[model samples]
Target chain A: MLPTSKSCILCETEARKIYAAIFGGEIPLAVLNRFVVATQRLNANVPPAETDAYYRALLACDDLEALEVAARYTRKLPLLTRKFRLMAYLAETVPETQDFFINDRSNLLAGLWAAFTGGLRTAVKLPAGLWLLRRCAHV
Target chain B: MSELIIVGSGAAGAAAALALADLGLRPLLLDVGHTDPGAGPRVEGNLYDYRRRHDTFGLYIGEDLHGLSDVLTGETGIAKLNAPNAAFVVQDAARLSPVEASGFDAIQSFALGGLGNAWGAGLYRFVDADLAGFPLRAADLAPYFDRLTGEVGISGAGDDLTPFFGATAGLQPPLRLSYNADRFYRSYAHRRAAFLAQGIQVGRPRLGVLSQPRDGRPGCDYSNTEFWQDAPYLYTPAVTLRKLIAAGQIDYRPGVLVRSWTETAAGVVVDATDAATGAALRFEGRTLLLAAGAIGTSKIVLRSFRDYDTALGLLENPAVQIPFVLPASIGRRLDAQAFGLTQLNLVWESPDHGRLQGSLLELTSPMRAEFFMRFPLAARANLALVRSLLPAMLLMQLFYPGAAQPPAQLSLREDGTLRIRGHENAISVRELAPLLGLMRSAGLWTAPMLIFKPATGHAIHYAGTLPMTESPARYQCDPTGKLAGAEHVYIADSASFTALPAKNMSFGMMANAMRIAEAAARR
Candidate 1:
């Protein structure tokens, strides 16, 4: 029934405080339930603002190892941003052999550059279901 | 008539042109390359290959005369070898050989804008350590920094050098961090304080891009792979040349290369040859400034004073590259380039969350090796190999490679020409350019050395040959940027650089050139 049940490779576990901290301040009320469901799928159903704060905290506090650990549990791209294109790019393409996270890394930025630059052109036809892509590293 | 006659059109030469324009005295600005006055984007080499993902990696096995290029031997030596089809003024010139021991300024750049066309727009200034043995200070260059930022339009954040000098010349609101950059963010913005324990400081890159745009230049589109190819995004000096021409400050002379300059008691006279027709024309001036780049200006000096300065050897400097892998998880985080300094990360840990002194905050992006995967490689047997393994090349340059290069020598051959030998992980320019690429070297044989081992060198960070210093052992220019030996010659280039070139040498070089012109104008 959940997205992670199908695509996620990492083990799904109960969400930590960091999860709630990453989805900080901004989330439309209509999509809040969808975000809650996606996280519930990852068992990371913390509050949105907490998720964002945690993301920032990770930037200010955690090292790469901790960041990786957090990444593994993150099952879905935040539905609020509709960064599904980034996610699809990752899943469709084979991850790199050497740099473990490169596929995720490339797709994330390339997708963002594309989405951000193409913001005014065609937001309607976009995938991942969000006006702006976030959380998901899909290219 | 003049003190020095500089040749070539590029960063070095353009800086000279700008410097002279400020002085109110018009120095002879002749270009031998493509000096046509055409409007609109005129991209060479990049236009055809713009959209394609091509890896410019490889080796050129040939005989070269001057010790300028790095394609043949990684080392710089005066040896001649197999030549290109026909070395014309542009891509199609008459076949020519160099005269043995002929002091010729066989420098690059004949275009109206010089080498500024192919720049990536990464600008940085030297710190105290970068200055090292040099006898110059940030205060001395204060005004030039002011003048250049006013003219060139640099973008980015940080206290590296620009902030201290002050002004938001061309920075837009600040570019957004790509989601990909989070991997290297820690190593970048949130770097470990341990480096401070080791005296290492990681910061963001301060570049010359507008978060917003100004000076008639448009905002960055960010669609192109490299900024150099960002036709509509960047505002190169050629753009500035048009403005200068409109202002009636810059005169136009396409196809004219100053063959030589002879200074007499009255003034200086420059001899130029129409690169296309070989027809010689002359220009005279009260003062002269050398804008030919490091190897360029020095070669010009070599041509000017055959035995004037014995310190012209490229051997005097050896730029070193010190690279290291960021802590595991940090690699991805720090490798991401956002609106901050992705060019150079000044890493130093703070007592709290370590702060980065760079221009952009790392977000995420494809690595060089990984990005190169987009191109076709003969080595790859299948689509799987190319598709799967390409985008993982995020390597941080611990310190810019070629940290110190001895005064390199670009000899003028019998018939008249020159060459160089070099690569990048740090600058841009192809003097002995278009050398072997990093990805190619990384892909083939590197002895398993990390990116640091075979550190890269780009012509972007220009320096040495004619360093500006008060002492003979220190530099060749005065505090005001005048060449020490010559009466009226001044260098407004990296050659006048007494320190290791900073992240944005163009801005620095531009500023330095302005300073030299300011002084010359006063005289």
Candidate 2:
């Protein structure tokens, strides 16, 4: 059985492969790990109900852009557009690892989403959205 | 004559009237009741006495009084308050209130000011993050919010100048913080330094109360007395219409009860009966706004469900109130933000006391919500035995998201009065412990929170119905707040909300409402 046709709720793509190879995908691992760590920090203060969603989004998204885009579908339905914008600044603010490949698969992961968003928009995002979405959870 | 006939004279009705008046549209406004400002029930005689024929509280409890031809036939009207029998039927109905299977709560207020009249005036804005996913931003909503604030005048501070403002913030100047509120923030700020450290805003409470007269409203007295009926600074819709009537811009048709409507290509011919005469009049308007509160508006929409398939969805106040005991203050402390909801747990330090912790983090001294708590009394004594301690109950409301499914049938009897009933997922004590703890630690619980249990009493923040969908087929209204089947008709109140956030949703909706109106007007 073709494991059920699914479309990324954001991108609205029906199992369409993302052109991560050409347009680029995934955040640097250091930043991805940083988001993972920050997501942990976010949980310490907020309600567990809210924390779990935030943590899950950070773990799944490969980059900040994808994560922020994922937030467009998360249950809490938080607005993370600014957080997505902030990721660029955040990346520029921090030092990067020399061995990092910007499009590394290790950096790629699934992120959270607002329930109402559609297929492709929810899926096939870059680290820019993911990085911001992860940071917004700390908010 | 432009032939504008406004339906209710509450916040939205009055605001619309005033806004229209400013726009040079002097349409006739009709209310079922009339009153004089600053008059202690001594102002005037009923200009149009629908009294004998009108349902006494038709608008008050219209959503629940399902089968009543008595009021119209002069068989029944207002119920006596003091007499146990006056509202006894309603009480009994409360006993048999339906579970959430029906998917909505049926609440209506007939008080003169409409729902906004009874509002606690806790004004706050939707966070920028609240608006992040959507295409619209603060700049897009600037004009409408500016006009609303210029006309209505809200009072607020923190969310104001923080570049963090979404289009929904700064609707009006913010309200002043209460004594208890000032104390609560000072304590709670220190407890949660980690979150507050990230430049995350702890709100400066805002409210619809005016600090100074703008558009003729008086500054708040801080008395908070209108807890029941009429008082200044209450900011109920009644006050606006009542004042506008004095200005000769709006007229009183206080007891006019809407019977039904016939859908027409142009619009609807709303059949209504005069409360005093029992006579029928079919009023016409090119435009109509149902700014009636959640249940009332939804009830009317449900009444007209045949015209629109998506009419029945109610952005339910899947209201949850969590009560928690503050590790710091425990029981003796009480506090909140401007609009009766302390949405933020602000932590700050007191000038006098020096403690190790810099920011006084709160969400510590949670409340004993009357509804959530089960203070086990000596077996056999119902909660009534110790009703004096009702104020002791607390609840920090967790404004959850969910919509009440629209009722399949919303029918009104010959008298133009109807009744509806509904509830939510009632969690067990253990399940509610954390929520209760949250409230207690946060100190946002209300007195009703202490009684046997409260169910959505003040979960008044409305939304989750009439959402904007990418597919026009899936939505009742677009993100712009226009109902799908009908053009030139839109929802300006909380009913336009599809996703209910934690903050007060009115500011957000009004901003959208104004934008929709502006767009519609341009068209």
Q: Identify the candidate with maximal TM-score.
A: 1
List runs of model 1 lying over 4 Å from the truth.
Answer: A1-139, B1-8, B19-27, B33-107, B127-129, B159-171, B186-191, B225-230, B307-311, B315-344, B347-389, B398-410, B413-462, B471-475, B501-504
Residue B60 in model 1: shift from native, Å? 20
In candidate 1 chain B, where is summed lDDT lowest over 10 consecutive residues?
B78-87
Model 2 CA lDDT for position B272: 73
DockQ of each: 0.01, 0.01
Candidate 2 residue-wise lDDT, A1-139, digit = tens: 1111141232211001121211244554433433333323322334556534544443444443354444444423241222221122122222341111011111101111111122333344533554556565565
Which 10 successive residues of model 2 chain A have the least lDDT summed? A106-115
**Per-residue lDDT over B152-261 for candidate 2, one digit per residue giving the tens place of the 0 to 100 score:** 56665544224333433444454555444454555446544443442223455455666666665566544322232333443555555666678777555666655444
lDDT of 1 by residue, B1-523 (tens): 3333445456555665666677665555555555332222322333113212221111111122111122112232111111111112123322322322222213244455555654546555544444556677665666666665566666665433333324544444545444333444433334333343443443345555665667566665443223212344454566666665677765655667555567767666776667668787887776677676665566566666654334444322122222222222221222222322254444322222222122322212222222221222211111122223322223343223234333334455434554443322222323111111221222211112322223223223446666666764433777677777666666766777665533445666766666676777677
Against the true structure, candidate 1 has what lDDT? 0.41
DockQ of 1: 0.01
Query: How big is the RMSD of model 1?
Result: 19.0
